[model samples]
Target: MVDQLRPNPAYIEAVLADAALSPYRTWMGLGITELECDRALVVLDIEDHHLQLRGTVAGGVMASLIDTATFWSAFVRAPADAGVANVDLRVNYLEAVPKGARRLIAEGRCLRPGRRLSYAEAYVRDERGHVVAHGMSSVLTLAGKGLAIDLPKYLEENE
Candidate 1:
């Protein structure tokens, strides 16, 4: 049986439908291909807006991927009643994504999990499987903060 307390990877469409994630889902074409208690896989389809003046993927876009990946990795392990915040984020751009690259995939791993804080790292790769960026972040669970959707309800409904 799946653990209802944990984020459900199977119902990605339902999870992404939450209003809080609308920007990432609609604007950035971000999708969660995999999600677990301590890891996540996020993908972004390459588009014209993702490119910079040089025609390479913009650094901000890469950073956003890292941020989203790390955040989700940690969030999956956080308390169900709390909301997570990325307190610190650090990313290193390793390569420029070629214009022809179809998509970027980010793999995130939670290094440590705690009631109040969590640490996560993410690596972004181009469609060709070349590492383009690496990042790490610290996430904090804030009391009295709740997500826009009732996660437990969604999970139960979907299940």
Candidate 2:
């Protein structure tokens, strides 16, 4: 069995707290409360911006939640020097989130890990624990085409 490196807790914490690291996450007001080898838990506090003209949570918001959650779940299994990109994502919106819903939690789990591909599934739930959306995604891992930013060096410098 190949040994897998667990993501550092400090790094995850810093990533979540620093807006500069992920502008999209900051803009969406999303937080990652749990990140492990094969699972990730993300949360979003519903705001007016998240609602549509109908006063319910927009479909795009749920899509984004599933996308983010699945990415994190499969990312952990990727090689350190590899870049993972979602090649395919399928989402099913089950229930509408009312305007007054306070929060939404998205949980993602990696279903399969591979050298060049990974599969993940995610679910978005309302504060009442009703699943609002379900999603599945496949990520392609690219070797020698890692992220442009040097995350470790940046983290060290920031610390």
User: Which segments of candidate 1 are over 4 A away from where they belong?
Assistant: 1-14, 19-21, 151-159
lDDT of each: 0.80, 0.82
Highest-scoring model, lDDT: 2
Candidate RMSDs in order:
3.0, 3.6
- Residue-by-residue lDDT tens digits, candidate 1, 30-101: 877877787889999999998888899999998889988998888765555566889999999998888688
lDDT of 2 by residue, 7-69 (tens): 666555544455236778888988888878889899999998998998999999999999988
Spell out the clash pairs found in candidate 2. Answer: none
- Whole-model alpha-carbon lDDT for candidate 1: 0.80
Q: What is candidate 1's CA lDDT for residue 84?
A: 86
* Cα deviation of 79, candidate 1, in Å: 1.6
Candidate 1: TM-score?
0.84
